[model samples]
Structures are given as structure tokens and as C-alpha cells.
Target: MNSPVALFQELVQAGPPADAAVHFDTACVLGGSIAGLLAARVLSDRARRVVIIEPDDLPVDPGPRTGVPQDRQVHTLLPAGHQWLERWVPGITKDAQDRGASLVGPDQALTAVNGVPLAADGEDHHLLAIGRPLLETLIRQHITSIPNVSVLKARASGLQYRDDEVSAVRYVTTTRADGDEQVLQADFVVDAMGRSSRLSHWLGDAGYDVPRLERLEAPINYASARFDRPETTAELKISGVLELFTPDYPSHGVSVAAANAIEGQQWLVMLMGYGDNRPGRTMEEFRSACAQLPEIFAEVTAGAVRGGVVTYHQAESRRRHFSGLSRFPARLVSMGDAVASFNPVYGQGMSSAALHASCLAAYLGSDADLDQAAHAFFDLQQVVVDAAWAISAGGDTARLDAESGAQVPEDIRQQRWAMNQITAATVLDADIARAFNYVTFMLRHPATLADPDLLARAVTVNEAARVTR
Candidate 1:
């Protein structure tokens, strides 16, 4: 060991060696969204410099941005994501909540599934809901606190590599000082570029067989509009919602009272559908979707000032088999939408991405084994994501919709039994609801429902109901 001054001398004389070797001292993270930011934070801690390349000039305040379409829609940080935020960057939630973000206490935002009411003490958990822009802006504020981090207004073009090692992150930027082409040379580069990422193509061109992406696209349409908060205790709607998404009715919708959720004030409304039954972005079409609902949702929405409907259309859940890649570079990784993007109807993106961040931290913390770490990280991700897909998609397959082609005989039987069990259980059992919370919050897997006590009760309920009806 040497003193700080002597260490510098020894390092220079001995070619700057360390107890542990370093691949690169800097990383260029592509994309500046939630996942991109999370990946950048991790890279910042390990590298000497971190640059976040975001094509869209993001908002400096708590408002909508042109880049992220879903910003205006309802978004909430799941408890799992919240936990990671507390760990990765303290006071993030506190700072946002201090503004106008409303906190939905553990059990206050009650849910009724398949007609069963869930009861809870609401003691140990809480999920704070804030507008997407506010949440990201608050986080971006935290990012500025880190000296090594800087955001570049640029559009990433491609990746350049030398012998499988990424050399520079190629990009085109007009907003920087003189508006010229630029290259961010670094030891590592991360693709947090989200759903429209071109990372795979860039990697393919470098002679690496990119991951085989698994896509289960079924067209889904969403229309969302923001309204001023309602102003009346009598007119106020406190809880969120859940609806039909089965073979008989292949889609469901939800409405949330988001930031500035005060009595007699404005709130945001989002109406969505699966397959060909998707919702429309037009104010007229949006009203029609709401009218289809029983009451309150559309009625209240109709009376409020409506922001023009915004639409998001995508029909598949895609996951790249990156861990299965035979050849990959060290210090290179993909997280969030770059790796996989789930059907947002499930609201698992942020939570699952947080789980993925822990994977990133864990991978970096352990001994240097990039490939092993990648495989292990994604393997864990597969469990969480696949479980959610099964619950959401399997439920979709049960709906009797025009576009949801008939299921195979075996699949039919399985869907029937599974749907009956889950729907009935969710509506009736608090424990089942808790199990669902576990899955939703990323604290446990869906198979956690297989617990003896919970599963036995569910089976008993299923069998007794079958006998009675």
C-alpha cells in the first residue's frame, strides 16, 4: 500500500496497475429515460465519467416531454421500484412527495379482483404515485448531484467496436456548443435506448450474433387525456381500477387520480384495449370508450376538461435472449426496454427494471465474470417477467374476443382452470391479493402462490365452488 501521492507515482511508474484491473474508466449510456437513468447511475459509480445521450431535450420541470409519449398517461412507482430508489438514491421519493405527488397508502388504494374484496392493515407498504414527468425530473435533479454525470442533447447513430470491445458511442448532436458530429470514447457502452433500440443491429454489424428476441405482439391501443382535478368530496374518486382481459373480453381499462389529485381538481384518464378492440385517441372516441363503462369513469371524464387523447399502439411483448449469446463483450450490457419490453397494461416496467438494476449492481459487485454475470442476471429476470406474462397473457387468452382466435384444446382447459382459480381467488382471498402484491411489487414470483397454506385454501375454494355451482 502507498500514500495518495506515492500511489500516483507508483501507478505512473508501473503503468497504472491496481489490485483489480479495469476495463474502462467511462461509459456512454444511450437514452435518458427512467431505465436509461438507472443504468447510468450504476455505470457512474463504477466508471470515472458517465455520459447520458438523450435525443429529446427533456423537460427541466414536472411536465410532459415530446419524446416519451406515455408521460402524460398514468404512471406509478411500484413499491419495488420505490425500494430501489431509496437504496440507489435516497430522498428521491421524499423530494417528489413534497411537491404534489400523492401517496397511495399500502391498502388505501383498495382492489377488488374477480369481485372479491381485499382487506389489509396497510402498515408495511406504500406506493407513491406521481406524474411520469415529475418523477423523472425529480430523479434528474438527483443525477445532477453527481459530478461525473452529464447529459448530452444528441441522437445516437450506432456503435463502433474493435475486436468485440466497444470503442466509442457514435452519435449526431446539433445542440452541443458548435453543433457537430461527436464520438464519446469509453471502455463500455450501455443500451438503455428503450423500445426502439438499434443496439442489436449495431452489434450484429460487429460480427456478434445478437440475441434472439422473443416477441408476442398482439395489437393494443391506448387513449389518454389529462383533466383538471375535481373539486368536491362528493364527486371525488379515490381508488384506481382493474377490468376484463380474458378470452371472452380480451381487454380491460383503468383510470388513476394522479399528481395534483385533490378534491374538485383535475385528474388524468387513460382508456386502453387489447387487439382490434383498442381505444381511440380522439376526444369523441375516448368519450365512447368511457361511456361503454358503467358510470362515473366516463361521466366524470365527460364533465372535466380533457387534454386531447394521446395514443400508443404496440401488439407484442418482446425479450431478447441476450444471456444466450455465445459471444459478447465485457463491460457491455443492456437493461430495461433495450433488453425486453412488457405489455404496459400490467404496469411492471419500472418495478422490473429496478429488479434488473439490482442485477446490474450484483453483477458488478461480484468478481469480474461478465458473461457469467450476464447469464445469471437475465436468468433471474426471466422468472419475474415470464411469470407476469403468464398471468396477463393467459388471462387475455381466456377472454372471448373477436380477434383472440380460439385456444387449443389443452390450452383451453388450462386457461379455464387457471382463470377460474385466479379470478375467484383474487376476489375472495386477502392472502391471494397479498400474493398478487408480491408479484406486482417484484418482492416474490408468481409461483409464490403455490405456497401450501395459500394454495390449499385456493384449491379448497375452487373445488367447493365447483361442487356448489
Candidate 2:
């Protein structure tokens, strides 16, 4: 059997199957969010029929739904995520851009980590900055356009098992007064139900042990609002991000300015806080929070027209240890936030989901046994989860000593310090900035920051900054 990495490479190169060749009879995906949509698209290539079970009536236009509370929040697709999405759904980025999404290169954006401005010379990665709702809507449209994929408006209640393998999904339609229940039989089932997933309970009901959960308590809050972009600020061109996270100041915030999907000149500004420092609900309070942020945010919102304020709170980042389970049911797999959810501040959730979709596609494309494929998929998915978990949870650990428990090892602490120093030195050296940007954009692993040559340059730059100060 080809290794997961080798299979993924082959899958990416070969692209989707030439025709709708059926490898499975039926595949059902629980949840119609980005993760499920992506999974359905991949499953459509292998299954004769694909069904996505979602609770809410999906929007025809880019609009908010009660199911996705964070739909209104600012979302940026890392370069790696954008690449996978483009590969899976060809011309997706172009479709989004045609609808008002902006493709921003590294040089085009104003970015400041801690308080130092990142040097702009060596940034080659470009990001898609669009509203989350619009992105999801576009993906849903694409997935439903596939010949074999269909979405049902129903809530997934449980899984029906024949012995150890899941055979069908039990669901109840939301439209009925009595809530009539239905069963959809499938050869494969995927849980893409986000953080609110009940896969553990369903597994336990099927006589399987529930996976243990690993959590990092970050306790973050966000207050955001859209605003009319000042015509004078057009010269800034790219979006602006101001992130301040340090050991001394555990209370950190981020401000992002991006073009709205409907209105090109309008932008959304989000203000976030860590721990007990929450952003205000009123427009004045939101602006006050922005004022306390870096100078760039304050200037952007100084005379800008305000929109309605929205607030969200996240208590922890969680990962289900599904890969560690000794015995797992066959024909069942979990993806997206159902398996792992990260702190939203890091913007890793959607991108990580895209990577998981890629892994699923690789596994389905191979000739691996169905039962063994579950294990292989979990193992490969963990690789994606760990990379994102380390960045999000490790970042929280670096800011608050109280949150930095045994889960954060000593080596990770040292690595975080090295990365912080490198970020600080980016203000002086553009090469260091470019290397750091690569890690941030998920194009490369965090281990790249510790390269001997890069570390040496970081040390020299830090020493020069120290002398200048």
C-alpha cells in the first residue's frame, strides 16, 4: 500500500477521477458546512450517490445562519488552503474574486506582530480575505452542482451499526411538527458537524469507547463590526492585521480590515481580546477597544462609519484523540471541528479542514482496504491536526503562564521563544520576515523556523536591535 503522503502526492497530481466511477454505493456526510461540503465533493468522485445532512436551511445568498455563529466573523484562507480548494473545485478562487473577494499578496498587507511591523520584501504567499458566509455559500453551490451530491435539511441524531461497522445514519427532519425520523443507509459516513458534533455519543451508543479529548483553555472573546472604507485609505491597498501577544501582556487583541463581498469599498473590522478582556458591544465601546489596539487599527476606525457590533466567546481549543482509540468502527470517519477545533484567532480552522478534505480524497483514491483506510485516515488526519494544534495552543501557552501546563512541553516553549524573536527581528530583516511568513501561512512546518541558518540570522538581527535600542 502506498504511504499516505505518497498517495496524497499522487492524488494531487492525477487530479479528480476522469469520470464518475463509483467505488462505493452510497456516502452520507453529516453537516453541510465547509468541511462537509468539501468531503461531499471528494466522496462524489467515488460514490454513486452522496447526501449531506444539515439542520438549517442553507442560504441561497451569502447570509448568516444560527447554526454557524461565527459566520459573520472575519475569515482569511491561508495560501495552502486556497491551493487545495482551487485544486478540488477548479476556478473557485476566481468565482470568489468575481463576487468581490480580494486576493492579497504578502507585500500588499500591513501586518504587525507584537508591536513591530513586519518587513515587506520577501513575502510571496497570497491570502483570500472574504467573509466566511460567502466562502461557505460558494463551496456549497459547487458541491451541490456535482451530479451525485444532494443536501437534506435534517439533524443527524445517531448512527446505526451492523456489528462494528456503521451501516446507516438516523436523522429527523426539522420541518415536521412531530419531527419524523429517517434512516439513510450508506457504505461510508463522514462527520463534519463542527465543534458541536455528537460523534462520541453515537460511537458509545454503538458499543465503542469514546475518544479522549485534549483541550487548551485560552478563553478568548471577539467584538467585530463592518465599516465603510475611507477613500483615503485605499493606498493601503492590502488588508491590515495587528496582533499583540506577549508574556507580559496576556490580554491581546487583533484587528483585520478586508473588503466586504457585497460592497467593494466596505470593510469588516474585528477586535479580539484574550482571557477576561472582552471587546465592547456598542459601537463606541468597539471603537474604544480598537483605539487601545495598535496605531494602525485606531487610525482605520478613527472617522469611519460604524456597523452593528457582534461578539463571540470561545473558552477552549479541543481535539478528540480518535487516532489513539484501540478499536474503531469501520465505515465511519470524522473530519473538521468534530475531530479538532482550534482557537479562531489563529485562523487555522477552515484551512485545517481543507487539508483534512485532501487527506480524505487521498485515502479514497487509493486501493487500500476500507477497514484499514479508517486507521490510515485517522493517522494522516492527526498529522494535520497536530501541526495546527501546536500553533494555536502553543501561542496561547506563550501568552499566559497559568494556561501553560504540562501539555506544553519545555521544548515547545523554547521553540515559541525562538519564533517570537524571529518575528521581532522581522522588522529589521526582510528575509527573516519571509521565512516567518511561510510558517504562518501553513506553507511550511514550524520546524523550519529552527533551521540553523535562519536561527543564526535571527540571533544577529536581535542583537542589532538590542544595540540600537
Candidate 3:
């Protein structure tokens, strides 16, 4: 008899007694980052008030905000991410395209996998690569457009909790005229503060100890440059996409046209690392990285119409192990980079965030409890993110397996064998390719490849291809 949204509102507003409405009136989001804003947007429906706190002064025009350094960088919403965004924001993808965002077909752009060129058969897979800041600007505007959300320019200095539950969000924020300390009370608190979350320290302050933490370095470095699209190239108005390497070379590059309008019309070239290799920023080094695959990257840039070098750094793959924790707060949740960060080379961050947001919507729609929601969220997120990571890291694992004293142990050989088949099969069979594309796009589960019928098809098809090769 009641709407899903209405039921979710009731659940969020209710007390520990679950069925009783304790009247949760306020919620605060840390960092005003993408994740934070999305969380605020969702919470706004239930809370009497919602505030978005950020350390930097937000601009009136869409530009890079100080908070997210990756803002100026290139970001892509994989199909999985696209579907997830549609669920939460609804029509935002269309808005992005209408507002000058280019939509390219899956194989339309340059993408190389496993040393072989992905045939741009001109169908199915699609990628929406835009500047991070541009995408963030659109999302920020949408959040502001929402009726009950407000933005606050403040850096969350710390957090406060009571009765083993998050009680308040503390911050030291600066305004146009002055700066001051603030403590906003709420029935819920969300740490959407990106990879720099202080939830661990905040928990310690409240006398809670972190049970488990696992952090590893992918040792990735990013160097980007903007170049002029070749005038001779007729696809100027086309969604220009470029790529290098196939499968696990542990490195790749992307050359995407500007999102909307950058004062100057140009395309962006971003080269990045996965296991240990990094994208070089210098014109020479950058060209060298592109040179590895002279068929597309270097050749296209050779005729590039315009832009210059801009290099950056990101090293590390982290997971908070929050799901393994025995106790956690309800109504209080997180998504995006706040949960896990991937090797940026894959451009899976936004999509992973979107998938997580979709989880929130799914859990809210059902009668799942807080614990159930958190667990379900992470479980699903692991698939979305790890699918991309596996492909990215699987390449690394290949190199490791080839060398002596590899970091990955021998316990997962069987798993790796199956993955190898899937990899080989996708290259030969369109059926396998479609299945693989679905996983890469976050459209299907990674385990889908393991299906007996599908795996048999992959094996049969790949075996035939090998004889021809």
C-alpha cells in the first residue's frame, strides 16, 4: 500500500526499536565530495535537514573544487556505473550528454586488451568519459537543485558519537568572511570524505578500536596531457576514443575529447599504471607510452591538433574491511571512494560508487536491516569493483606468475586458470566477449564466466581459435 521511497523514509526515521519512529530530524555528510553529496541527497528525503560540509570554497561556475584533487582528471562512467547513476539521479546521463558530454560506443573508442586490439565492431559497449570536475559540477548542481539539501564550506576536523553510535559531525570550516568550529547534531552521519576518511580516528576517540585493516600499494602514477584533435580526422564531432595494450600489461592510456567545453577545444591523453608501471607526463615519455601501441595512440597524437602535459600521482589499493566489523551504525552509511579505492587506470571509481548507491536503493526498497544493508552493499560492491580490479590486477598477477618470488601465492591457481580461459575466450568468441564486456561494464557478475554452459562455450570457441592462430 506504501511506496518504496516512503517505506525507506520510515525505516530511516525509526529508532533501535525498528518499528517505532524516533523522529530522526537531521543528518550531516562529511566532505561534500561526490559520495557525500549522493548520501546527503538520499538522506534528505528522511531527515528534516541535510548539510554538505567541504573544506574548500565551492565555485559558482563549474570548475575544480579544492577538495577533490582528481577533479581535473579524466573519469569514465562504465555501463555499470551508468545504469547505477540512472537509478539514483535519474536522467543525469542524458543531462550530461545534452550539456555537451559526448557518448561513445563501447568499442567506438580506443581500447586494447591482452596485447590484441578490441575490435570496435561499432556496437554494444559504451563509455562516457568526462573530466572529473565536469561530472562533479553536474552532480553538485543536481544536489543543490534538490529541495532539502544545503552546502557548507567546512573541513570536518573530527567526529563525535554516543552510546556506541555516531551522534555528531565536528568540523572547522571557513567562510567568505570568517572561519569557525561547528558541531552539527544528527540522527545519522555519513563519512563520504573519500580515501581520507577519519572514521577510524573518530572511532578511536569514542573508545572503539579498529579490528582489521588491509592496505596495499598498486604503485600507480598518472601523467596526462591535452592535445588538439587532428583536423584531418573526420571523427572530430565523433566520440574520439584511443587505447594501448590488451589484458595485463599493467599499463594503458586514454585519449578522450573534452567534456562539455574547455575554453580551448582539445582532447585529453591520460596514461596510467596498475601494478607498478606508471603513465609518463613528459611529451617524450608520454609519446613513448603511447608508442608501445603505435597502431592507435601514438599515431593519432602524431596528428593531434592541440594541448600540453599535466602529470599526477596515485599509489595504493585500499579496503577498510568494514563489513567484517561486528558492530556498526545504521542510517549511517557510505559509498564511492569512501569505501575502497581502485587503480585509477581502469576508470572504475565512479561506476563502483554508482553500484554502491544502487545497493542503497535496493536495500532500502527491501526490508533489509542496517547490518544487512551494509553487508549487501559491500558484497555487491566487491563484485563491481573487483571485476575491474581483477582484469587490471590479473595482468599484474600474470607478470608476477612469470617471475620468481611473486607476491601472489599459489593457492589461487585454479581460479586464475579459469580466468585465463575467460580472457582467451573473450578475445575469440563474441559470445564470450559480450559476457566479458558485461562484467567490465558491471552489467553482470564476474562469476557469470564460470557458468558451465558459458565456460564450455568459451573453451570450445577459444580452442578452435588457437588452432587457427
Candidate 4:
């Protein structure tokens, strides 16, 4: 099977035929978030009209809104995600860079899994460091600019079905009361309403069985704040991340010196902890939390002007098993956090969403039946979700094995040990570091790190490090 990256490359090289037939007259996206915008962008090519129904009147500028509470948190576009966005929205990276966003090598901001600074290997694997709000705004601007795409400020109330097929979307304008609902007929309806989606409830109401849900409860919490980049630390262009979420240690700290897309030199620092070790909202507590992780966090935060601190709590990572459902409504699909939401600390949500959008595009471009597209899209989306889940929730599960009273299988245990050696080897070997970076960025599969040759080198490096210690 082709990787998502390869599929995207093929799509880019073989642009849609000029005389391609339209499959649908109209498509409705239930949310105006990143996932919805990307989906609408793709739908514009195959559908005569695409409507993005959102509750909030999106801002014209780069600023936080109430719709996405996590917009203020630290965010970076992984290399794979950056490529997808650039392909979907031409000149998007340049547009963001022109407005103070920076594209920096991943090594500049990364620390090895063992708390050692990663070596600068001079390889060019650039990742985007811009505010999440700015990224969303730019994407929205691009999608809305397409001739067939438009935005409507309204809240999706439910799905209206004709016989057994999804036929229309019921919604109410933001200014209107509940009784004054309106319906928009659509050939297709997509739910990109993030983790708060009501699609499952709406499905149950429509007499369809709700999909089974799989959840991993890590019970993690985060506290994030922006700070003026200290003049003393201006020379350091990279960010600092100290992850200590092993079975022994459950706290993590990250200080990202991202170029604010709107203006000014600022660093977004976020501290995360699992269960009872949650980070505090106060400045002093934040400092104390950082002091517990690594010295770099305290050093960078010292003498820095602070911004408002925001806290968020997440009980679990969730996945709805839509692909496993015996029956699903025709002409309806879900994407982004609505389908699967991972632990944000792993930074896989946005990239996974981008990959899902690519899957949607691939399905839309096919000659398959529209009524059966939901199953095919969900099957493809499950692959993307599985990879992300293994990376984020899998790590959390491994770290909390003892606390959760879960037993790791023997084969899985060996794999984890090999992965640990690879992580340790990254501090000494640039090649290993590159492989680790690629896996972390979702550009490559984790299995790539466990190749026989690589594993041999990692074991050797691990033994040498142990002897020296």
C-alpha cells in the first residue's frame, strides 16, 4: 500500500483532469476548524458547492477564539503535516513565513528521549513554528478563496435523512433561536467538529447504532503561557523540550521559541504532567514545575516577561470505531478529533488530521460509489489513526504500565527495549537521531527505527553507554 506521503505526491503530479465530472452538487462540513477547512478544500474540486457551517464567526486576523480553547497552547507543524498543508494550499508556508512564522530544523528544538540535547547533523528537516490560531486563519483564508467554497456562521443541530441516506443538514444561524432552524440539502455531509462532535448522538437519533468507542485514560493536564524571549537567550533559535514521562517519572516540560505569526518575539512554554502531577496555573508554580524537569527550562524562563497562563485537562484519548460498524449512514463521514482524539502532548492531532484529509481527497478522486465512500474512507482513516495511537497513547500506556497494573506482552516488551536503546543511541549517533526525528514527526513509520541493522547499532551503543556509566 502507498504511504500517505506517496499518495499526496501522486495527486500533486497528476492534477485532476480538466474535464473531470462533478460527483456531488453540494457538500456540507459541520465545523470550520482545520480539519473542516482542509476537507472543504478537497471537496471543492469534486463538488459543485461546499459549505462550512461553524458556530463562531471566524476572525480575519491571527488571534485566539472561543471555539478552539487549545489554540493558545504550543503547536508546531510536523514535517509531514507541513508538506500536506503546502500541497493543499499553495504558498501557505511562504505566506506564514512572510508574516513572522519561522521554519526551523527539528533538531534545533528537540532533546533526545534520554534528556540529552540532540546533535546538529546539518540535515534539512524543517518544521513550521507558528501559532495555531495563525495557522488556522491562513488555512481558512485559502479554503474560502476557492470559488466553490463558502462559510456559514451557524451551529449544526442534526442530520436529516431521506429514506436511509443522509440528505440534508439541520442548523440554526448564530443569531437565531432554536425554533428558527434551517435545513441545507447536501449530497454529502462531513463532521469535523473536533472532540465535541454530536455525530454519534445524531446517529442514534436517526435509528443507527452508534459506533463503539475505545479510550485510553492517561488523565493528563497542561498549563501553558507565552513569554517574551529573553534578550540573553535570543542567540538560541531552537526550542527546549524535556520529556520525563517514563514509568519512573510522569512530568514533562517544553519551552518553544516560536515566531509569533502576528508580531513580536515570544516563546510558548508548556508544562505537562499526568494524573496527580498536573502543572499549576500560577507563575511561581510553573517555575517550580519546570525546575523539576530540566535546568534549561528554568534558564530560558528566567527574566522573561510572562503572558496569561491557561490550563487544560484531558481524561483520555478516544477513538470511535466507525469502520467496525455493521452499518453506517450513506453520504456521511467524520474526520479529525471527531473520529479520534489523541493525547495532545504527543503533537500528533494536527498531522493525523492532515493525513485524514488526504485520505478523503484520495477517495473523492476515485470512481467508487458515493454511498460506499464512508466505509472506504473510514478504513483508510483507521490506518492513520492506528499509527498516531501507537505513537502517543502507546507511549503513555507503556509509561503507566505499573500504575495501571497492565502487563506488557513479551514481544511488545522486546520492541520497547529496542526502542529504548534507539532513543539512547540518538544522543551519540546522528543517523539514529535523524531516524528518531523522522518517526517523531510522523514522516516515517516507527517500524523504520526497528530495522535489524539499526537495532544492532542501538544495542551496541546502549552497551557502551552502560559500561561508561
Which candidate achieves the best lDDT against the true structure?
2
**Which 10 consecutive residues of model 3 have the lowest summed lDDT?**
255-264
lDDT by residue (174-235, candidate 1, tens digit) is 46676566788877777888877898898788777788887775566766676665445324
Off by over 4 Å in 3: 1-23, 119-125, 176-180, 230-264, 274-278, 299-307, 327-331, 365-398, 404-411
Global lDDT of each candidate: 0.64, 0.77, 0.61, 0.76
Q: For candidate 4, write residues 1-469 as lDDT tens digits.
A: 8774454344323333356568899999999998898889778887999999999979898788888988888777877788788876889999887876767655456654435666555567767777888889989998999999999999999989876779999998988765588999999999999998999999998789698889998887778777776556766655544344344443343322112212246677777767875675788887776676655666556646557677888899999988867667888889999989988877888887888887787677777688753787887777777778878887777777856678889998887788778877878777787888777777776666769998898788778878999
Expressed as tens digits, the lDDT of each residue in 1-469 for candidate 3 is 4433333223222221223222347778876766776666566665678888887777756676667877666677776666545555767777777665656665345444544644343346567656666677778888878887898777787776665566778777675355566788876667788887777776666665452544554565666666664446435444545453544453343322222222234456666554445556578877776676544565445645354666667666665666545565455566677777776655667766655555554444445554322555455444444555665565555644655455555657666777778767765766777777666666655556667787788778878877887
- How do the candidates rank by lDDT, highest first? 2, 4, 1, 3
RMSD of each: 8.3, 3.1, 6.0, 3.1
How close to the true structure is residue 218 of candidate 4, measured as C-alpha lDDT?
81
**Candidate 4 residue-wise lDDT at 214:** 91
Backbone Cα, N, C clashes tallied per candidate: 22, 0, 12, 0
Which ten contiguous residues of candidate 4 have the minimum total lDDT?
A: 254-263
Model 1 lDDT on a 0 to 1 scale: 0.64
lDDT of 2 by residue, 1-469 (tens): 5453344333334346666456788999999998899899889988999999999978798889988998887777887778778888998889988987777776566666565667875646767878788899999998899989999999999988876778899999999789778899988999999998999987877768788988888887777777766668756665645465454543334433223222355577777777776776789887776666666666556545646888889899999987857667888899999999988877788878887887787677656688542887787777778777877887777767645445567887677778777877877898898887766676666656778798789889999889988
